[model samples]
Target: MATDGIEAVFLETHNWGKSARFFQALGFELDFATDHSSGRLRNGQGAYVFIAEVPEDHKPGMQVVLTVPDAEAFRPGPDVEVVTPFEDTHFGTRQATVRDPDGRLWNLQAPAGN
Candidate 1:
């Protein structure tokens, strides 16, 4: 009915490959890469995170992904807007995006196979 805490944290990097490797060296495992410029790493539990290449237009920063029972059910609040509709990822998860008042993007993800 309500969103739990953060499910993942998305880090925007100029070089996703290098950032992924750095996180791996810090004890994370490469979960999968959706494409050449973006991928995911996890600590082998529930601590999965993402590394994405920032476009020239989109300001880069931390994107806190929330755990909602159903990403499809999360309606955009009063001032928020749906940036990206829910879709299945290559790594096997459902994800969508929303924007806060300040325009910071937040990714909402449902567990893989849900």
Candidate 2:
């Protein structure tokens, strides 16, 4: 099945408070937060931003999350390259990663029970 649409843009930041405040200053409203470590923010038009503290030993990066009806059913065409296989995440979602021709990463996710 085709992907539904962009789900959320994820940001891995070293300073959660500083990054969150930066977005907030740009007019994004906080939708929810978890322990000041991670949060979901939304713009007036409904676009979402998901920020989380960078994990130890992991380099910070931006990830564009795409939503699909069922992650297991996603089929990358011959031209697309798979970086990671579909798997269940600790956050309770099914997801996979793929790399585009220029080497940019795309994260495909399906909500729990999808």
Candidate 3:
């Protein structure tokens, strides 16, 4: 099946509180925060943003995720590079990685199982 389109954004930051506040000031509300200084924020009915803290040495980056009703049923076109096959994520979802023609990586996520 085809993808459902942009779902969420995975943002990495060295300072979780500051990053969260930045989004909050933009009208996003906290959905939940993990004990390890990570959280998800939502604004209205749009895509949610997940902010996670990483080590200072790690370069912070943002990733856009596309949602599929079922990972097992999703099949990408030839132009897309399958970096990693669908796998289970620690957050209780099935996820896969694919690359665009420009070499940027993107995520495909689906709920647990069929």
State each model's CA lDDT, in order. Answer: 0.80, 0.87, 0.93
lDDT of 2 by residue, 44-98 (tens): 7654999999866889889889888886577778987989888889989989888
Better of 1 and 3 by lDDT: 3
Mark the regions of model 2 whose C-alpha exceeds 4 Å error after superposition: 55-59
Better of 1 and 3 by TM-score: 3
Model 2: residue 90 alpha-carbon error in angstroms = 0.9
Worst 10 residues of 2 by lDDT: 67-76
What is the overall TM-score of model 3 with all chains considered together?
Answer: 0.95
lDDT of 3 by residue, 1-114 (tens): 889888999999999999999999999999999999999999999899999999999999999999889887787888889999899988899899999889989999999974
Model 1 pairs whose backbones collide: none
Worst 10 residues of 3 by lDDT: 71-80
User: Backbone clashes in each candidate structure, one number apiece?
Assistant: 0, 0, 0
* Candidate 3: pairs in clash: none
The runs of at least 3 residues in candidate 3 whose Cα sits more than 4 Å from the true structure, single-residue gaps closed, are: none
Best by TM-score: 3
